[model samples]
Target chain A: MKNPYQDLPATAYWRTAVADPDALDITGLWQPKFPITMTDQTATSGSCFAQHISRAMQNHGFRWMDCEPAPPVLSPESAKTFNYGVFSFRTGNIYTTTLLRQWVRWALEEEVPDSEHWERDGRVFDPLRPQIEPGGFSSVEEMHGARAVTLAAIREALVSSDVFVFTLGLTESWRNSETGLVYSNCPGTIGGEFDAARHVFANDTYPEVYAAMADVIEMAKVVNPAIRFLLTVSPVPLTATASGQHVLAATTYSKSTLRAVAGDLANAFPNVDYFPSYEIITAVPYQGRFFEPNLRSVRPEGVAHVMSQFFAGLRSVGVEVHTEDQQQTPTAPPRRVPTEEETADDVVCEDEILEYYNAH
Target chain B: MPTDDHRFALIGDSNSAGIGRVARSRGIPFLGGPLSNGITLDGDFFDVEDGDFLPRVDGPQAAGFTGLFKAGLPILSTVGFNTQRIAQELHHGFYRPRGLDHSALSDNVLRQAIEDYKPGTVKFYRAAVEEGCDVYAVYSPQRFPEPWMALALRLERLLSGMLVEMGVSLVDVRPETTDEAGRLRPEFFTERENDQTHASDVWSAMVLDRFLDDAGIGVMA
Candidate 1:
C-alpha cells in the first residue's frame, strides 16, 4: 500500500523555487514563509503565524494588501507594546479558513454582504481586543457601525490581490445551529451564553477541511481566476478546548488534521502550495529552543531563521511567472449570499474532497 | 486571615456602576476605584418605542430593547442610536425618555441572572453561605435624574437602603453633596446645562472618596 502523494516528486512551494518556471523545488517546499518581493499583490490571513508573516513581508517592502494595518498607527509606547497596526480596520485574527477566504473575497469586492453579525457586529466585540477605557463606545450599535467601517477597508484590499496566503488554524469549531454559521469562540467565553440551539458542534475531519480549503481556492479563482494560494499550518496550540480532551492533545489533533488538509489541497490545485511552518517550529529537531515560556509565541530569533530560509529559496531561483495586469482586470461582481439552490451540490462527502491528495 | 473566595459584585444603575471617565485632572479615576474588581459592564440599548409611565417588560417595543430596567432610566434610555437620534431631534441636548417599568424588570433581571450564576446576591441570601461572595453591590448615579433636581438627595437615600438590603454595598454621596436647600446640588451632573443625568467629575470623586472611607479598602483621601 503506497501513498501516491509520497511517491510523486515534491513541487516548489515558493514563487521562484523552480530554476526554470517549470522545474521543481521540493527542498524549499513547506518551509516557513518569509515575505519576499513578488510582482504579484498578496493578501495574508489565517492564525497568529499569518500575522507575523504579513508584518515581516510588509517590512521586506512587499505589499500585504489589507488597508487596516494591525494597530492602525504605532503609539509612542509602540516600541514597548510591539504594535502591529490595525489589521483589518477591525481585528485581524482569521479564526477559520472560511473566515480567511471571506476576508479575501470581501477585500476583492467579490463579496459585499457580510456574514451578517460575524464580519459586521461580531468583529468589534472580539474578546481579543478588550475595551479597557470608557467613553469610547456606550452601545453595541455604535460598535456595529465601527465594525462596518473596518470591513469596508478590508474589502478594498481584495480588489487587486495576486497572491493570497492563508494559515489554517483549527478543525474544531462552534457553528450556529440555526444559521449554520461557525463562531470563532464558544458562547459564555467571549460572546454570550452557549445556547445548544443557537450553536452546535463541528469538528471537521481531514476531508471536510481539505474540501473547504479547495473551495477557498475556487472562490479566489472566481475573484481573480489567476490568483495563487500559499497555505500554511499554524504552529500555535489551542488556548482552550471544548473537545472533551486535554488542551495539549486537542491542539495536536487540530493542527495535524489541518496540516494534512493543507497538504491535500495543495496537491490538487496547481496554483495552491503548502508551507510547513508548523513542522519547522514544532516537529523538526530545533533543539527545544523555538518556543517561549508560555509555549505559544515563537522566539523572534527562530522566526528570523524560518524566514531566512524562505527568502534565500526565493532569491536563489529567479523564475518569473506571469502577473495579471491590474488595468485588464475584470470587474468582479458584488458578493451575494449563496442561495439554497446554489449550495445544493455542496453536500460533498469528507473523502470526496480529500481524494486528490490521498490517492492510493 | 481570608481563605474563602469572598465574591463581590456590583449591581445598580450606570452612575453607581461608574460608566463615565474615572480619572482626569479634574475627573474621577474609573479604573483605580473600589469598583475595580472583575467589573464587567453590559450597557442597555434603546429600541424604537413610545411610552411615558414605563411600559411593562413584555410590552411592545419595550420588549424589543435589550435591558433589565424600564422607564427612561439613566442607563437604559441613553443607549443605542436613540441617544444620538434624540440628541439631533431635541437640539436642546436633552435625552428623551421612552419610559418603561424599572422596578419590575430589574427584579426579573436580577432573579434570572442569579438563577444562572449562583455566586451573586441571590446566593448570599438564599443559601446559608459564609465563605465566598454571594453578596453584591449595585450603583445608581442617575438616581436623582433630570428636571426633578430637587428630589436628588431624597432619591439617593431611598435607593441606598433598597440596594443595601439586597446584599449590595451602597455608595451614597448625596448626603455630603446636598446643599442646605436639601436638593441635589447642581454640580453633580457632568454636562450640567445639557444632560443632567450623567455624573460630573467632581461628583464622581466625591463618590469615590465616600466609597473608600466606608469600605476601608485602601488609602485614599
Candidate 2:
C-alpha cells in the first residue's frame, strides 16, 4: 500500500523546495488565488513597503489607481516632499489594522473620530495624520478640511478600484483612552503632547488583529461587493517597540501576529488572498541578505526580487504580465518609469522618525 | 513738474504695456520703446521735453527688465497675471485657495499650493531686490469673474507675501479697482471690445496716481 504522502509536489518538502534551489531561482512561491489583469484598477495602502508594490505595478503598465494625485503645478520633487503619490490616498502609513479600520469607518461614514487638533508654534496639526502636512496646517479648519478631502478620496478609491492590496505592517499602536481614536503615530512622537493619563499603548494580539482585519474586509465588501483583497505582511522590522521587549523579539511577535491574521482572513474570505512577500524577504533560506545594514530596512534588491516573483506568479497563473516593449507599443500609454527619487530605497517610513528617540 | 531725472520704468505683461499706451495717448510726459532694448528718452513728450520713459515690457523681456532695476529707477512691476499660466498651470482652471469655504480642488492640492506654488514671477521680484531698486509690485487687478477672479486674488496674495519677504513694496489697488464682491468693476475693464481681460486707461490712470504718490514723485499735469 502506498503511503499517504506519496506523489506529493516538490514544494511540500523542505529539502527539495527550500534548500535545493538557488534562493533567487525559487519558482512557484505564490499561486495567486485570482488573476489581476492589466485593466484592473489596483489601490494600495498600509506600511511603507506597500509603496514598492504600487510603484512596481505602475512601472509595469498596470493600472495602479492614484485616487488623490498631486496637483499639476507641483514639481516631482515637491510632490514627494509633501507625501503626494506615496500611497493611493494621503492617509500616511496605516501601520495597524485598527488604524486601517478607523480610516475605513471614517470614509464610510460609520464613525467619526474626535476632532482633536495639535498646535505648536501656532500651526495646527490633524491628530489622525499628523505628518501629512509638513510644518502643520495653517489653521484648525484647514486641517479638518484636508482630512475631509482624504476621506472622500478613500471612499472613491474603495468604490472604484477592483483590487485593494493592504500590507500588514505592525500589531502595535497608540490610541486615545477615552475616545478610542487610534493615531498614525504616538501622541508626542510626531506632533501632539504626550498625556500619560489619556494616551495608551496597545500591542494587539492575534485574535484582535484578525477581528479588526475581518471587520475591514466586511465593511469594504458592503460598499464594494466585487472588491478583491490581496494581503502581504511587511518584512521591514519595527523601528521601535513600546512592548518593553527586545526590539528583535517585538518585531518577530508583530510580524507573526500579522501574518497569522492575514493568512486566516485569506482562508475565511474567498475574495481575500495572501502573498508570501514576508517569507520572500525574511526566510532563513535567503540568509538575511535582503535587509540593509541595520538589518531592518528591506534593500532595493529585495524589493526588486519580491516584485519579480509577484509578476512571475501572475504569469504562472496565465495572467499576462506586460513587458516594457509591449507597454511601449503605439496603442498603449507609455509605462511610467520610476524616477531616481522614487526608487525603492526612498520609502517614507514615519516609524523611522522614532530612530531619533533611540537611546545609545 | 516731474523731471526727466525721476525715471519711472513700468515692467510687466500686456497690462503693463497697456498702461504705457494709455499714458502716451494722454500725452503724459514719458520715454522708452521695447523693454528688451533698454529704456531711453526718445524726446516724445508734451511737457518736460527731454525725459526718459521705460519701454514696453512683456514676459520675454523679464531678464532685461529686472536688469533695469540697477539703474536706481522707481519701477512699478504690474506683471504675473498671465491668463495662460493661471488657467493652465497654477490652478488648472479649478483650484481654490485654502481656508476658503467654496468647494474647488481637494485640500491636498490647495495645501501643496500653500507650500510650493511659487509663481514664475517670483524670480523677477527676487532679482529686483538683489539689484536694490526702488521696486513696487502692483497686485494684478482682477479682470475675470468668480472662480478665475478668486484664483487671481489668491495668486496676488501669494505674490504679495513673497514681495514683502523680499523687501519689495506692494501697491494694493484692489480697494479702488474691485467691487464689493472682489471682482474687477465692469467700468474699470479695458475699453477695447476685443479685450475683456485687461484694465482700462481710467483704471491705469488711477493706479498711476497711486504709484506716483507712493514713490514720492510729482505727477505731471
Candidate 3:
C-alpha cells in the first residue's frame, strides 16, 4: 500500500511550500470550497479586524453589502463615530462567537436576552453595546427603537448574504448568569454598575467556544441554505484580563482556542472556510513588523498584505473577481490604523476603562 | 506629558455660555482653578438619596434654592431633549415659539438656523471628549414662566442628563440665579421677556469658584 505522502505535490513540505517563512509569498494560502464571487453580497462582523475585510472589499471592487447604510446627511467621519457603515449592520463589534450566536438568536427570535438597559443620569444604555450610542440613548424607548433596526439588519445579513466573514477576537467575557445574557463589556468598567453577586466572569473553555461557532453555522445554514461562512481570527492581543492569570497567558489561551474553533469549523463543514490572515501577520517569518509599537494594532500594510493573499488565492482558480473589479478603482492604499487611532480602538477594547481607572 | 495642559471644557445650552460672558465682563480670568471657599453643597438638586447618577462634583450649585421647586426639584429636566430632537426640528423647520416670549416672525428662517446649531451642540460636547478635556457642564438657571416651564424643564433634563451620561461633572447654578417663581432673575436676561438670556458677571464668577473647588485644579489662581 502506498503512503499518502508519496503522491502529494512538493507544496506539502516545509522545504518546498514554506521555504522562507520570513519572505513567504502568502498568496494561494486560502481557497474556499464554495467560491465567493465579486457579485455576492458579503456581510462582515466580529472584532475590529473584521472592519478590514469590509473596507478591503469596498476598495477591492467587490459588491460589499451594507443593509443599513448611513444617512447621507452624516459625514463619513461623523457617521463612523456612531458605527454606521462599519460592517453590514450596526451591531458594533460582535467580538466573540458567543456574542455572534447571541445576536443571531435575538434576530431569529430564538432567545431574547432580557430587556436590560443600564441607565446613568437618565440616559439609557444597552449593555449589549454600551458605546453604540455616544451618550447612551436618550431614553429606553429610543434604545429599543434603534435596537429594533439593528436586529432587522442582522436578520437580513444572516439569511440573505452570500458570504459572512467573522473575525473572532476573545474568549473571556462577562455575563449576567441569572439572565443568561452576555454583556459587551464588564459592567462598571464603562457604564453599568458592577454587581459582584449578579455579574459572573467567564473564560470560555474550548468546547463552549466551539459549540457556539458550530451551532451558529448550523442555525444560519438552516435559514439560508445558500449562505457561505468564511472565518478569520483577529491577531490583536487582549487589552486586559479579568481572569487571575497574567494577561499574556490569557491572550494566548483566548486566541489559540478561537483559532482551534475556526480550524475545526473549516474542517467539518464544506461550506465554511478559514483564511490565514491570522498566520500571515502573526507568524514568525514577518518578524512582527505588521504590528504597531503597542505590538497589538495591525499596521495598515499588514491589512494590505492579507488582502493581497486573499485576492491572489482566488486568482489562481481563474476567478475573474478580485482583479477584474480592481481595474476600475486601482485599489486605494491601505488605510492603516496609526498609533493615533488609540481612541478608534474603543469599538475593539473596553479594557481601556481599566487603564483609565488605574491611572486616575 | 505636561501636567499644565490637562484641559477642562464647558458645554451645554446658552446658560453655560452665559457664565463665560459673565467672567469676561468682570475682567477676571476664566474661573476654573484652585479652591478657596469651604466646599458647601448648599442646594444641589440631585437626589442622591434615591440613586447616585451624576458624576461626583461638589453639588453646592443650586444649593440655596432647592426650596424654590417645592413640588420637587426638576430632575424632570434630566430626561430633557437630545440632539435627535434638534435634528428633527431642523428637518421640520422652525419650532413655533409657543409660550416663549420670543417672536417667531421668521419661523422658517429660524428653522434654517438649525442647519448651523444642532450639530454645533452635539459636535462641541463630543469635542470635549475627543480633545481629552475635563468636562464640567455648568447649567445656569434659565427659567421660564408657567406653561413654558414644563417644556423648559424637559429640555434641561435632556441637556444635563446628556452631559452626565457622557461623564461630565455638573454645576447647577440654579440656586444662585433662579427666582422662587421659576424664572430667570429680572436682570440676567437682556430684557424683561427673558428671550435673550445673558448671565451677569458676578453670577459667572461665583459659578467658576464653585467649579474650581469641585475640580480641585485651576490655573487662574
Model 1, runs deviating above 4 Å: A1-38, A69-91, A101-137, A319-360, B1-221
Name the runs in model 3 displaced over 4 angstroms. A21-24, A322-360, B1-221
lDDT of 2 by residue, B1-221 (tens): 23454457776544565556565555664422123210111111111112222233333332333335445677776645443233334433224322223333434444345434433355556655766677777766576544445555665565577568889888778897788877788888766544545677687777777887898877556
TM for every model, in the order presented, reads 0.46, 0.85, 0.59
Clashing pairs in 2: B31-B53
Q: For model 3, how does the per-residue alpha-carbon lDDT over B124-182 read when each residue is reduced to its tens digit?
A: 34434444445565654453334345434544555566567666567666766778755
Candidate 3 yields a Cα-based lDDT of 0.63
Model 1: fraction of the reference interface contacts it also forms? 0.00
Model 2 ranges off by over 4 Å: A324-360, B1-6, B22-67, B83-119, B219-221
Worst 10 residues of 2 chain A by lDDT: A345-354
For model 3, the DockQ equals 0.04
| Candidate number achieving the greatest TM-score relative to the actual structure | 2
Best to worst by lDDT, what's the order? 2, 3, 1
By TM-score, the better pick of 1 and 3 is 3
What's the best-to-worst order under DockQ? 2, 3, 1
> What is the C-alpha DockQ of each candidate?
0.01, 0.12, 0.04
Say which docking band candidate 1 falls in: incorrect
**DockQ computed for model 2 against the true two-chain complex using alpha carbons:** 0.12
Q: Which 10 successive residues of model 1 chain A have the least lDDT summed?
A: A348-357
